[model samples]
Target: MAPMGIRLSPVGVAVFCLLGVGIIYHLYAGVISSRIAALRRRRTVDLRELLALSVEAAVLGGREVKRAREENPLEKSNGKTKGGASEKIALGDQSSHRKMYHLIKNTFPFLQVNAEERAPAGGEEAGVWNHVIPADLQLVGEGREVSADDITVWIDPLDAAQEYTKNLQKYVTTMVCVAVSGVPVIGVIHKPFTEYTAWALVGSGSNLQPRAPRGGRSLRVIVSRSHAGKATRFIQTAFGNETVVHTAGGAGYKVLALLDPPDEQYEQADVYLHITYIKKRDVCAGNAILKALGGHMTTLKGEEIDYRAAEANHGGVLASVGRDHRALLAKLQSADSHRQS
Candidate 1:
């Protein structure tokens, strides 16, 4: 049987083409609209939600950290880093780091993240998301628009490797910091062994309780235990002889001492003073947390650190809680004047 074909007139052909074009255009427009909606969702992230997510991620990472430590005890790592023992990664660190990296990436795919640990060393357990916002968190503004270019997430899966190696899990912490336009706006510090997490959103609020503020003379200063000799000498000369000096490991641990304080080695810290160059990730989270508490962190010369800088190294670190930040700097200045004469 021969097939019969219907030949279309010129006008009919034009109509058919227009119909095809219209269909294609509609499909394309639908796709574009969907894509735009997706982009908008990714671009706008609630700071509170980020804080909650960060706490969840940190808690999840902490589980891995504890498992790693228990499965295989960390022998003291032999190395050196800036101002303290070198950054030592163990089975726990790698696994925890990988877990944290994926969780944040999956949740906030559009964010640029900088993590201390890069790859997973071996097989490990995964984590579940529990978006936990603090009960006491009082968010500042209802909502503020944040552009994509202004946000970066900093992750340090295992903060106190040295202490961890020494079986001092008290100093160990898993940290996350969210910075916008070079300003750290959100921070989460989780103590794996203790199973406690502290989170803060800048210009918002945190769970930090009101404590009796301290300042001026008789200031209790906290410095790095690995290299405290120089710092102790400098701090005493700058502040005064009566200033109490306590030592601790891990920048995150030190910062925590400034807030709630620990009962042991790093006790009663009014301010955390590090007179050596250090990485931004080490301080970014703590800095954000302190900022939320109305505290301040700066360089030795009293200059604010721009967390967005490409070169992560900054010249020393000075963080003070409550009302003593400026006063500490002024005291240092006075000491400098006395020395110059």
Candidate 2:
């Protein structure tokens, strides 16, 4: 009405422009968020599928191992003695584990077993056509293989073969560790004989957390429910006299058995203990998940264990559960010295 023309106030113009930009940004953010959520969902689905396939293959492999055991028992009972005599055995039971590894490789041609083809980062490539790089969960999907940058998968076939050969109920076969870098974000342990598994994942949040498997409970160490050694006795003394114990074989099996209870026993019995002192392959994925969920794995010297280093296999691991576990570990160290002396 001022001059029969569209004259707008400065404030009005500023408000309108601001609203327009805000609206545009809001729409863009919504789109981006939707995409991110969709990608996450897809990834979850893919992970579930891959896990299912792995479990299935491992089960089949277990059957094969059982069959082999039945056909040719690893050890035979000595007629002269009531106890069975130890017999020479192969380094590895190569039947089920090796067969499955190659089978998975053959079936999924795109997936790189332990290494993949990649160009060198800086140097000029000459001797090799492609540089091999370690990948996390490189799976062959249909015609293409998906290479995830965030996730990693490590497989240790035949974790407790000695126990398996001995036909110990506690023996575990494959140990799978999922990690981001050297930190294990998830852990899976499968026992061939029982056809059971235990798994853990790093939960969501700013702190590293425990991701329990279906009907799974948090892990607790159980050192030789029956036989107690000097090292184990030292640990028990620190834990307390009433502390419960479970029988398990090998570090890998010991760790897994902590998560899984025998059918005759209770699922999870609450105690003051938490898992620490796990080996490289033993706690690789478990430690990753724990750290991601705000936990830490270190050595008896209170130094962080570097998974990439060869020293990870040397054992003598010390891990803490929550911040208070550090105190317990210190006491255990004292006990260790006492036992050593």
Candidate 3:
């Protein structure tokens, strides 16, 4: 029989307290999730707009390159200069390309603004945000800034220069990254040319969800199909020798490859990390999505990839599931050394 009075045991009281805390945490999580979702919506729209501008720039740059190439070198050589009386054409196609790149690069601040605006005054947020930027893409780890908020975006508007220059149908303009400070969270890789987008939200436990034009397919490791070099071989060996590598161009495409299904040419695997040189212009939009999802991203050497400095060689990147695969990285490093030797 039950007691008439409200007989509560000590354990019962403790359990009630725990339940109350859990309820509070649940509500807090809901609120935070909602805020994060709104941020993502705004950020994504901004990125798409920038990407459009970048593509336009690339098209215009291509025209310049073509015109410069056709600038009658023979006629200039035939003319006479002050020394030998010859007139130089000095067609500035390269200069035009640089201007186009800068146009896209300069637009990063608007996408993820500085974290200083959101951080508490006089807090320990210094050197934590990005404020520098890079001058070249061939190099790594340059020009970027650090902010109070732990978010970054990586974008490569025109990947596969050969394909892009050739006006190939398969080329991709991509944007992707490891969002937040270090965790590889949500990621978005969209192919503007094809109107295809791949996104994933990674947390403690990983779940692969899909978007339109396709159903939910599990996220996988997408690599360069054509550039099957020592690095690719090592990845295949670790994840599985038979792992399928997708040859999608562009940084954004690679990030998307982690989530997007394998088309007729590329088969998908079950792991991915969209690592990039720590640069703001290359990462902001994609970082927002990755953070919102769940996973985190960092350099292969396991340090915070700062965005405030402006140089290009921030070492390589490692983004994946489960725990950090240091062993795989070691293998790649070893392979690289062996190849060099």
Candidate 4:
């Protein structure tokens, strides 16, 4: 041992060991960082596929009618019926929600918790995304950084539960949307009955099949089937009697109708209008698809919906298929002004 050349001292051996450890740690960190970047790049596609699966699960679960009462329940003025026969109905909304949530969790355990759950119940914790960068990532246009905290997933397990219950299969849709820093980047709209799936990434065009031509005779408008209130009627009146109005359920359905209408009898909507407040889950997916098609969705005030806000949208929404947006906005403004005067 004493004859060995260049025998290192104790201090030198410790320094060499430290350097080796440092090198190993650095290499490990680099590998991890690279993996994260790759995952982020493919996140949009992954999410879209996952959403399609989840939507399918929701549709399957929603179709089950356990009891006749679940399909149609007799309404009573009070808890007790005149004949003293009480009935309980199984609501499709809750079952659809559970099915969709569990399907997604079983598929992608990483996105376990719902981002909308501000106060999660016992055993429910926030989703953990290890790949999410600690620092901001570029989203939307330039000069914007989407914080990791801003990333979230919005799901509408059953977009048109009312229609689903009524067996209006065409009106029902399962929607999933991904928002990076509150800006929707990926969206999936799946109709179980028709087996139609429409999806879109922020920069990429929509994957809507059977694309239809836009040229038509009249300015066709699509409005909410269930919640057609005064505001919606006012919008129709403002558009004038010449405009053709179609009633449909589900925000995704309305938007999809604009893209791929059923037949010549049903003309594609030029504008999808909602003149009342709606949850982000209702419109997030539709908005993303519309945007991918070179369309715009904004509030009556011409402001974009802030998905990051606790209340998804404060006012009405106007979604147009590229044309007539500015003209429609001007008419809406004029209508408001006339009403005020």
| Best-matching candidate per lDDT | 1
Clashing pairs in 4: none
How many clashes (backbone N, Cα, C below 3 Å) per candidate?
0, 12, 58, 0
Local accuracy of candidate 4 as per-residue lDDT tens digits, 1-341: 56768879999999999999998766556444544564565333244343344345434434532222256543222243221223222254445555555544444444423532321222322222233311212222232233335456677766665555556667767777767667776677777666566776666445553344466566778888655565466775677767777888778888887777443234367788887667777888888778777778888878887665564575778888747688888988888777778
Q: What C-alpha lDDT do the candidate models reach, one value each?
A: 0.77, 0.45, 0.40, 0.61
Put down candidate 1 lDDT per residue, 154-256, tens digits, no spaces: 8888887878877888889999998998999998889988787888777767766434685344888899887789888888999778989999888999898
Error of 4 at 111 (Å): 4.8
Models ranked on TM-score: 1, 4, 2, 3
- What TM-score does candidate 3 reach? 0.42
Which ranges in model 3 have alpha carbons more than 4 Å from their true place? 1-156, 168-171, 174-189, 197-220, 236-240, 261-266, 273-287, 311-313, 321-341
**Candidate 4 Cα misplacement greater than 4 A, ranges:** 1-90, 105-148, 209-216, 227-232, 261-267
Sort the candidates on lDDT, descending order.
1, 4, 2, 3
- State the displacement of the C-alpha of residue 282, model 1, in Å, after optimal TM-score superposition: 1.0
Candidate 1 similarity to native, TM-score: 0.79
Which residue window of length 10 is worst by lDDT in model 4? 133-142
Query: Ten-residue segment with the worst summed lDDT in candidate 2?
Result: 125-134
lDDT of 2 by residue, 1-341 (tens): 55687767999899999999998766555444444454554333244333444444455556666677667765532132111223223233455545445443433333323311111122211111011211322221222223444444455555544566676645546655544445554555566667765444444221112324323333334443223354455557666655554445444454433233342232232212223333365556445434544545556555565554332344355543334457656876787677668
Residue 263 local lDDT, model 1: 39
Residue 194 of model 1: what lDDT? 74
Comparing 1 and 4 on TM-score, the stronger one: 1
lDDT of 3 at 302: 48
